[model samples]
Each structure stands twice: as C-alpha cells, then as structure tokens.
Target chain A: MLNAQVEPYQRLRENLSQRDRSLREKVMTLEEAASFVQDGMKVGIGGSTMSRTPMAMIWELVRQRRKNLSCSRAITSTDGDILFGSGVSDHIITSWFAQGILWGLSKVMRRHVEQGLARYEEWSHMAVGMRFRAGGMGVPFLPIRSMLGSDVMDQRPEAKQIDCPFTGEKLLLVPALNPDVALIHVQRCDAYGNAQIDGLQFMDIDLALAANRVILTTERIVSNDQIRRAPDQTKIPFFCVDAVVEVPYGSAPHECFGIYEPMLNHMEAYVAKVNSDPVEGMREYLERYFYEPKSWNEYLALIGMEEVLDASQKGRSIYND
Target chain B: MTDTTRYTAAEILAILSARQLKDGQVVFAGVGTPLLAATLAQRLRCPGLTILFEGGVVGAFVEPGKLPPSTNDQRCTKRANMVLGSADVLLLLQRGYVDIGFMGGAQIDQFGNLNSSFIGDPAAPKTRLPGTGGGNDISSLTNMIVAMKHEKRRFVEKVDFITSPGFIRGGTSRAESGLPAGGMFRVITELAIFGFDEKTRRMKVLALNPGVSRENVQDNTGFDLVFDEQIAITEPPTEHELETLRSIDPERMFI
Candidate 1:
C-alpha cells in the first residue's frame, strides 16, 4: 500500500524553499552548479532546437566527464549532438534532433544512434510538453490525441491507448516525465534566481516545475530590484532554483533570444567536419572545443569576438523598439 | 550566380506548394521546404495567409533575404506577432484552429503514411532521422499538404515507418479512428500534383508538370499510381514567382 503522508509530489513540494528562500542569493560558480548533475541522472534541458540552448553548462558537464545521463528537451539541436558525442548522456528523449532544416540531419547523431552507441526515445512534440505538464501537476499520465494511429505510438510503450470515458473517443495517454535536474538559460535573472525568458518559452516552465532540482544559467545576474520592477516577467522563481550562475553568452553558437543569433559560420564548420568523419571528427571537435579549452571564456575566444558581435547585432536588431 | 529565369527542383516544389494555399488559412509549417513554401505563399500569392511554426511563433512576417535556418530561429519571428508557449500553439490543433500541416518526410506510401524516423529496420537502421517534431500532431489534427521531390525511392508502396498517419487503411478510417479535424489533403511534387481518393485513400495524379509524361510519373514512382479521369497540365512557374523566390534566398541556401 502507498503511504498517504509520503507522496512523491508532497515530498517534492516540501523541498521547494519557503518565503525567506527567495531573499537569499543563490549565485554559484558554473562548476558548482553543474556538479549537481550526477552520473545516470535524468536531466532536463531548456530551450528549443538551435535557440536558447544551455550549451555552456552542457560543455561543463562534458568537461567533467559526467556520463550515462538521460536527457530530455522539447526539441534538440547541436547540443544533443555534443551530449552524445562527449558520452555525457547515453539516453536522450525528445521530439526532434536535427541540427537545422537547411543543414538537414546531424551526422554525429546518425553515427551514434545507427551504430547502437546511444539510446533515443522519440515522442511527438505536443506529447512531450503534455507529459511534462502531467509531471508538474503530479499526475501519473495525461491523455492526448497525438500519435493515435501512427507507428510512433507503437515505439513508445509508455504511451497507452484509451477510450475517453466522457466521450467514448480514442486517445493516447503519455506518462509524466520528471527529470532529476533541469539546466536552463535566460536572458537575465537576479542572484536570487528570479529568471525571465525573452523568447518563446518552449516547455521550460513545465520542465522547471516537474524537475526535482533547477540549475539556472543566466546571461547576467541582475539586481533583485531590477527583477522586482518587472515582477510579471519572472518565469522561474527563486523557490524552485537551487543554483544560479552568470554565464554571459551561455547559449552561444546556439541563438540566445534578444542577445545573439546563431553563429552560422561556426555551425557550418562543425557540421562540415562532423559530416566528413562522424567518429574521429567528433572526437577532434570535443578535444578542440570541450576538452582543450581551459574555460568557457577560452572557448569564446576561439570562436572569435567578430562572429559574436555580428550575431549580436543581428539578433538584437530583430527586436524593434 | 543567381538564376531568376530558370527554376531549380526545390524552387518548383516551393512554388507548387505555395499555390495550394488559400488567402487566409493558418498553416502549421515544418522546417526546410515546408517553411520556404509557406513563406513564398505569404509573399507572392496569399498575403493574408498566417504561417505558424511548431516552435510557437504565430502571425509573424518573414523578412526578405533573411530566411530562418530553422523554424525556431529569430528570423521566423521578425514582424508583429504574438508568441505563445509551444504547447499553446499545438493545442490549437485540437481546437481546429490550424488549417494546413505543411511538411516533407524521408518516405511516403500510397496511403499517405510518412516515415521521418529511420530508413531501414527498427532494430538496426541505415540512416537515423530526427524523430517527429510536430509531424504527427500536425497530420493527426489538420489537413496536410506533403511536399517532396518525385523519386522512386521516396514514393514507396509502403513506408518504412509511419511517423505520421494519414488514412490508416483507407475510406472513413481516419474519421473512425477518433481524429476530430482532418486528413491528408494534397501531395505536391516536382513533377506532379496528387490527391487522396475519398473512397479508396489511394494516391492519384491530378496534374503533371510541364514536359513530364505519364510514363515519367509511372516509371519514377515505386508503386502503381491511380490517374484521375481528367489529368491536367501544370503551368510552369512564372518569371515573377521565380524571381521573388530567388530574391528570398539570394545565396540559394534553400532554393
């Protein structure tokens, strides 16, 4: 029999800090925040494909050689490739994983998945969000119409077919996906972890509430007064976040909304190299980008400031006053 | 050099897909050709058409000479629009708010089933595709316009996997399956335009492009295709359509 007093959700709620917690500064180093991710944990990544990806933290995990992690995102991009390539994550659950539309598929992913080096658990885009919603709400599962008759339903045993009790219509039920930790990047947030996301919040809100712990990486740690001035904008509260690290351009290479766009030249270079030789090329990329670089700043230096400046101008220009 | 008079294979596909859209229909566009085709529709023909990205961008005007590399890119959200959560936009499909699901897949069958997951066997596949993003949800809840090149290897008797379901086993099956909104409406290709027969759910050629013979259509397709009683000739892309499409992509990144 299940214990009524010790429900998993009740326990999780208790872990979420009380009133004074929001007042306390949650700032920490990137290394310290990333250390919360242990081997073989189910981690949630914020942002959609090629936009607002928490790449710096992922690189940190790779540098730390964190292995066997099961990661999930609403949609994935080169970050997923880095996770698989670095062996930081063995299992990746998501809706999609292409680098981009024009570039087509990721050769790094193709080589690893086809060769049986990693595990890929696929779900429809809506289904992934609804599953996270179910987790956040502390429900066992949520019913939706996605993958009703498609082979995608057959691939996922977790999703069940059920006749709607009210309307007698067929529906598919997807189970809750509660990750152990969530890595998110925002445009700006206070040291107290009052974070605000600028662009389309692709499922980060659901992921934040569902995950047991949240590691927030921000472009800059603004003052609490600044966050309070725009109280309505704070999407991630300090009560849910355990660590906050200010890593400017945290989502570099990948586009960071209101900050910079995708560094196409760098991405093209990466794609070309990886396509030429998936295995050896991937290893070299890791060594050059992840391993050899002493710090995140050094990696930025390698990418060159000119590319960053150009991307910044273009990305910021997209937003008209 | 940029060629405006001559259209490439991708250009023609974009043009045909654009022509299929009406004036003010909200389209759920996927990445690559679908996005380009939908944007071309908004620009050249239907200015009132609303292009929706799976990443939750709605009603944004794509700027000239700056096509987004992906659906979620900043370029996809250039003009005035409301940006909601990704879940918020896809949930509209359940409410019958979206009109078209424009996308392309790795393989498609006579029944309109799509395979975007893998090429070979499930256990051991030759090529591993990016799993269905909003492919299934889009096709399941709204009318789909599948655009792809006509090739024997692509148009198969049966898909390797059904990443998105169309008509299941034919007549009335999609409706019977409890999907409230829509089904496969049209299939656009470089060589011809086809539609699913209401009774049989089989892919049938409605029109052939200029210089494309019936034999060319049959020989290029993997399976036997049904020909409509009145097969029409598809008009070639006009100079304006070709020029505008080229201007959209001066570098020919996608054209």
Candidate 2:
C-alpha cells in the first residue's frame, strides 16, 4: 500500500501548504516584541498572581501607550492594576484579581471597575483553564462541573448549562479564550525559542498554543545545547514560540521561582501609595517605575542592589539569616 | 512562656480551623488563614496531611517564617512534591481528590454560602471584591472549613451573592441542585465555632470561645444563631501553641 501511492502523493504534497518549521532565530527586543501587540487584542498573561508575571513586557506596553487591550490571566495580580491605571487595557478577564492574596482585595482594581473605567470578568480557576484548554484544542467550549449552582454563571452569559449526552448529568460549558497575544515569562530559553520553566508551569503552555502569537520574556536566554541538555524541561517548544527576549530579572518584584522572591518593600510601598490615593498615586507610580526609567537597568537600579540580593537569597533559601 | 490568654482573633481563627483537619487528608488551601491553619495543623497535629495550593503546587511546604502572600507564591513550591499545571491541580480539586477546602471570603450566610463576588446589589455594587478564583470548584467537591472574623457585617443573614454554595437554602438543596459531594463542615471564627445541623443544615454553634458572652455572639451575628443546649467552651490556646504560632510568624503578619 505504501509503495503504490508514491506517484499520486507527490502531486498532493505540492498542493499542501506549510508554516516555516526550520530552526530559525526568534529573538526580538522588548520594544520590537511589544509591537506585535495591538489595541483591542485579547492579551493572555502567563503566570499566576505574582509569581513569574511578565511585568516588564506589561510596563513596556504601557510606555508604548497601547490602548483598549483585553487582558486575561489564570490569576490576575498587581499587573491588572497597572493595566487599568495606565489605560493600557480597559478589560480584564481573570480568576483572581488582587495585589497579593493576603494583602486583601485590590482597591486599585476596585476603583477602576466600580467607577466604570474598566470591565472585570471573573471565572472559577478551573473554568479559566478549561477555556484555554478548549482554545488549544480548537474547540468552541469545554464542559465544566463547577459554576453549576452559583452567580458566576449568571454574570457571564457566555457560559451555558446543558445536559451531558453521555452521562446525562448537568454540566456548564465555558467558551474558549483564545488571546491575540500571549506574554509568557520563562526561567530560560534558547535563542531559537525553546522555553523552559523551572517551577510551576501554571497555564502558560496551554496559553502559548491557544494564542495567535507567543512572546516570551525570559530571565536568561541560554544556548540550544543547554536547552537540549534536559529536553523534558522545555515545556514550550520552538515551534510554539514566535519571539523570545532575554531580560534578566524580568519578573523582578515578582518571584521567578529559583531565581528570586518578590521584592516586598517595592510591593508594599506601591500598595500603600495607591491605597491612599488611586489616580495620583498610580500616575506617580507610572512615571517613576514605568516611564521615567530610560532602560530596564535603570528600573532595576531603582529597585536597588540590596533588595535584589536580599530577595535572591530569600528565594534560593541560601541561608538561615 | 508565650501569653496564651491574649491570642488575637486571627490566631484563634487559625487555631480553631487547624483543629478540624485530620491526618492523611489532602487539603486544598488558599492563601492567608487557610494556609496558616493548614500549616499549623501540619506542625501541631496532622503531619500526614498533604497541602496543595491553587496555582498547581502539590504537597506544598510552608516555611515557618515565610508564609506566602499568595497560593502561587514561589515559597509554596520550594520543596513541593509536584508542580502540575493550572488545569491539572484544579482537576484534582474537582475530581474528589481534595478532602477539605480551607478558605476565606467576604461574606457567609446562615446556610454557610459564601460571597467573595460583591457586597452591595449586583446592579450597583458599593464595594466589588475579587471574584471567585477556585472558590466554586473547591466548595463544590470537598468538605470545607471556613475561617473568618465574627462581625455583624460578615455573619450575614444572606450573602450578597453565592460565589461558593454551602447548603444552598438549607436541607438537601445543595445536593438536589445536582452537586456531586461536599458541603461546609465547620465555620471557625473568633467568637464561636459553628457547624451545620444535620437535619436543617443551618449554622449552629458547636463551641463558644472562652470569655465571650452568649449575647456577644448573637449580637455580633446578623442572623439568629442556633446554639446547642450544651455548647462547649473553647479552651484558650496552650502555651506551646502560642509559642509555635509566634515563632512561625515573628513579625505577626498573620499571627
């Protein structure tokens, strides 16, 4: 059977189309990567809450003055606040939105949504993931067991309840959430864009495949040989990655797993200032942390070497002190 | 010796909630009181208990001085047994793997229904809180222990919105509404501990904290609280428990 089809297969092969599967370089500067994002696009942020959130890329987007972007994350955090505060993203779809889970609810997020400056949509953690799962699988929606008897379904009209054809039990269907751009931060990535995450992967893998484009901000860009040394650690392959930018401490002030812990002083200061006053506090913060810094290094300098080392030591658990 | 007599409301909440966790049970815990309670349980009582965080860290280890600010905090994963993806961990919570869910929310009703969604009317919310993350799924699938401050505003007659269903209007309603399993097992607060009456599923006092008057609990509660004829008085925190708790949180951030 294999040998007989060779003549007809060649003609069919010539008619078939393909995307570039070659190992081409996908490196780009943060500014260049930020260009791939546009207004009104559904931007998927990788990472949960504070850990490994792509704050640097988000900061760059605000600096570039992108507007009307719809953002989604498995769990939202202070980045959600920045998006609303800067008017970079007018809508946020997330499972949880807070500066820190223990810091109480975000007054910044509350002020924006309550005042009608932005729209906030909430989904159960499972529903958010299932939406991404459906998006990655190219399905319209996925069946869920939760949100069956709650106000969450009532709020989001997109979610529908139906009887399962197989089990004849009730199930809630959540629509696929395919973002226009997925911003993922990784522990390391090769220049060819095989990204590796050292700790909890969260939903970034599904998000990378579901989005139209994947832009990765990495803590370090290692060689392909280094990436290949432990191929299993590379959760997102080069094929899935469209662009990669190596920016050390990319998740600074937010923990990057084995790299560094959250810079508590920076976070606390921001939270205090913002809680005291929303508009002016956010504006001053944007100027100081996002806009005024000429370079990423300058921003890091503002965070200071002392806090950096301290956060790093805390993250690595290097000492008793 | 640590002063056990003057334990704060947070300390009492953690202590009471921690006591409910049994050994070898798999607990799905959120940040704040839940994590602290589970950690205290692991340290003081249930060493076999496996604590998992919402953001996919399974068998999460809680360092004494470093209680994470969020479930997804890197500290939650330092010595974790497995770091699954978001879907995988949430699936575990959905499929009956988790035994007890430890959580905190904005409001809870007489029937133990929780509201983390909004405070005032949905049409015009006076204060909008963070919406349900995994609160729905966790509450739907496993027994839950709620830890909250005992205030008139918090112990509401009815939640503004049901972000997590408890006994849904009491009785067999939650099950009749097509939920598989799980319901609120205990409601631990600073004033008293409550559990659902098996018949009515309404909040009934299981125990009262020492020195808190019966009128005080009823006065602080928005709804009429059901109290047993022989309500047990909660013992004050032991010297050891106080010392350990203080040691765990030297800065007293969550203590």
Candidate 3:
C-alpha cells in the first residue's frame, strides 16, 4: 500500500537518483525556456565577452520583452550590450566592457552608459567570477588579493575589506552572486541535461550551478548514451539544470569552440550598424535578425548554413593558415 | 645578411616589448599591442614562452596569419594546453606562477598606477572608458610590463583614478597598503622605455627608441622623469622580426 501522506518536498530531497536522474522532460523550446526568466530578476550569463556567449537565449529573452533585467557576470560579449541597448537590461555588474578590438559591438552599452540610460558597476575578472564561485559553493563570501589596490573595492557594494584572522593581512571579500536565473550556452548537451563545453569554460560551469534556476541552450542536442560514455566531459550534471533548449549556432557571430570561429565580418557589420544610430539601428537589426525569424531553423536559414559550416571547418583545422 | 627595416612607432614598441620576454617564462598578456608583442616573442625570440590569457587559455600557441581579436578569442584556445575558468587563472596569479603580466592602459601616473575606469569624476561627468578587465588581477599579483602610446595626456603626474595598483605612492607604501607584493617592472611606450628607480621608485628612462631624443621623451611625458647614467638607443626592428610580426597580423589591426 502506498503511503498517501508522503510529503512531496521530503520525497524530492530523498530521491534515489538525486544527482543522476533522467531529466528528459526538462527539454523545452527556446521560448518556453526563456519564459523561466522573470522581469526584474538578476541574471547571470555564461562565457566571456565575444566568446561562446548565450546569444540565442539572450535574443529569446529580449524577444519575450522581459524588462528591467540586471546582469551579473565577470564580463559580457554582445549579450549584455544588446540587452542594455534594446532596453531589456538597465544595469550590469562586470569588469571589461569593450567589444573585441576587432569588433566594437559594446559601443551601444557605452553610449547608453555615457547617456546615463544604463548603469554599471565594475569588478576585476577574478573578483567577479569569485562571487559566482562562492555562490556555487553556498558560501557567503570569497576572499581574494586581486582587487586590493584597485578602485573596484570602493565602487562595488558587495566588495568588503576584512583582516585575515591568522595573518592579520588585509584582504578583499567578494560576496556571493546568487542570481535568480542563469543562462548558459554550451557546445553540446543531452536531453537529460548532462552538458559538455569544449573550450574555455570561462565561469560558465560556475554560473550554471550557482543560480537558483539554470536554463541551458546548446549548439546541438545529443543522446543520453553519448553523455554517459564520456561522463568526465560533462561540466553540468543533470541535477543542476532546470531546463534545456537545443538551438544550433546558438552563439552565432561568437564562436563555439571546436564548432565554428567567430565571424569577424559579421561582428564588424553589427558594430557599424549600431554605431551609425544607436536607437534606430538596433530596432532595425532586432527586427531583421531576431523578430522576423519565427524559429531556430528560420534563423539559421537566414544566416546560411553553408557559411557556418565553412567557418566550422576553418575552426576545426588547427593550422588553417 | 643584417636586415635593416624602418618600422612604425607601434611596430617598434612591439619589438621592444617582445625582447623583454625570457625563454620559458610564463606571460599573462592582454589585448592590442601586448598581444602582438607576446606572440612576436613566442615566434621570434622565445620559442618556449608560455602564454596565459585571462579568458582562460593557458600555454596558448596562437596560430599564425590569424591574430585573435581578443585574449579570449577562440583562436587562443585552439592550440591551448588547458582551457580553464577565469577564477583558475586568478588562482595561478595568486600562487605567483605568472612571471610577466603584459598590459596597456589609457593613463599611467608617476607611481605607475593605471587608470582605465573613467576620465572624470567618479560620481559622473566626462568619458567612461572600459574599466579594468583583468588589469587589477594581473597588476596586483604579477611583475607587470606596461605598453602604451606616449603622450602628455596619458603620462600624468597622478592618475584621475588608480584603476590598478602600480607603485602605490612610489615607495614601501604599496607593500604597506596590504597588497600581495607585486607591481610594475617596465613601462614600454612608443617613444622610449621607462623603468622604476630602485631608491625613489620614480619613472626613469631606460632606453630611447630610435630617432627619439631625450627632449622628445621629456616633452611628451606629463611628469618629471629620472634618467639613468647612460640610456641606450632602442634597437631597430630587424627584417626577420618585422616579417614575423607582419605575418601574425597582416592587417596590422593593433600595430
């Protein structure tokens, strides 16, 4: 006879496959996954600026018209910039702001900041990532020596100065960044959410496990067998993932390691487009590239899969030069 | 054959910065000129140089003919030995594993403190440049080598803001300030190379770049500089060095 009084919350914590459950139903459409994001939630994004960023997820969030979102991360690529430029995000916590010297995509954010339309608080990469690390470990704060002599200590509200208990040396403490949701883009992920990132984790793994909810977007979706075969490659276990979305070329214009190289020409065009006129240019860009596309397949069709495949070939070749 | 080549100031700066790197040294390099210099060193001078990028690539063997757009560009990890998180890179810096931290800045004060945070008051007003990325992490923990274009505006008596620690008041004050004991070692500019004096910890001329006079260096600098007993002229870039550097960055994106 089943015990009818077994509390659901208690049963969930005591589940047998707590860490190794089959989360097949966790897979959802990009729009559905994006619905998990609420307005005014502090969001953390994966990847360094212009490198393997979660562009598709960001676009979905913007398309959904989620407003008043604030970003938390070590650095952002076009992800944070586009969000702020499109009026999706109003504030950001980061260190680096420049787009790649090759592509000045973040010029929009700069314009917004200079105009006082958006706000930003800066921290060194170490101090910023350490906050995510502390959050993942369920700690209140993490100690470091990096921001000791920088202006970041004075600006960041969470950055505190504390004396070492034993050594009596002054150290900087970065508080944990417990974001409401974390959006991460990776190279491959299984339906059950055992994900693998090929190159430069760059705080993604930390951000994935740290946030209250993790919505993972991937370049491709693989089977559970493939994930089990190389469990060691999995950076995020299924238990940590709240939902997953499969979107090919998810980090377009930004390279997904071992898949495609960042398209410098496309990025340059983006910068030029926005730089010509920040407000009108972005609206036109978003309309043409994001709003018009009804689905992921349509977006890729617009991007032309041949160009992507060629770039992928070049990226895979170690010495293409 | 002795190769004689007339190089631009940027090219000359890259070569001079490359020459400072020792074989088998671990270098933490930022983007722009520093990237060009570190790659030049790896290809031309130090084959054993291990390059670390704050974006998480370690022991990166940057591909020729395709200069990475940023330190974290996919090309940086293409031939990397290990791809780590930014936190791991900082841990390595904290452990004192990185030998040379090559960087560039908008403003550098007499004490070598760099300011890339903002141009005007902290509250508001004026220009807001990109704040320090790994500037604080690298400058605070490693022996730093700065590369910048020499101008009176960039070389200031005191920076508007100390975005990253240099000498911190030009004395034991840096150590006294509870820092982990690492600061600037060399300042490579387009016109001349500068170093910190051991006694007073002030900017001192180490070498003058080709065709640049002592007065040219002084006129461009915002602060008074100390001079070594004998400052040598910086060596002109050889044809091989120029060709190698050009091959890496054919477009001269940052040069």
- Per-prediction DockQ comes to 0.77, 0.69, 0.65
What CA root-mean-square deviation does each model show from the true structure? Answer: 2.7, 5.7, 5.4
lDDT of 2 by residue, A16-37 (tens): 2233436889888999999889
Question: Mind giving the per-residue lDDT tens digits that candidate 3 earns over A1-321?
Answer: 332212233433443234344555588988889887999988998888777788888888888889999798777666666888778899898887866666533567767887889887788989888888887776767899877766767776567788899899988878777677888888898887889988788898888767777889998889988988998899998877888899878888788877788866677777788878878888888887778899767766767777677778866775454
Clashing pairs in 3: none
TM-score of candidate 2 chain A against the true chain A: 0.92
Interface RMSD for each predicted structure: 1.2, 1.4, 1.7
Q: Estimate each model's TM-score.
A: 0.96, 0.94, 0.93
Residue range with the least summed lDDT across 10 consecutive positions in model 3 chain B = B1-10
lDDT of 3 by residue, B129-238 (tens): 77888998999998999998898999999988888889878877677667756788999987888899876788899998877888989998899999888999877788
Quick one: ranking by lDDT, best first?
A: 1, 2, 3
Q: Which is superior by TM-score, 1 or 3?
A: 1
Arranged by DockQ, best first: 1, 2, 3
Candidate that beats the other on TM-score, 1 or 2, i.e. the better one: 1
Looking at model 1 chain B, which ten-residue stretch has the lowest summed lDDT?
B1-10
lDDT per residue, candidate 2, B1-255, as tens digits?
113557888888888788889999999998788888888888898888899888888887688887787888777875678989988898997788988998986789999999998989876789889888889888987899889888899989899998998998898888766676899999988888899999899999988888777898999999999999999988877778877777777777776
The order by descending TM-score is 1, 2, 3
Of 1 and 3, the candidate ahead on lDDT is: 1
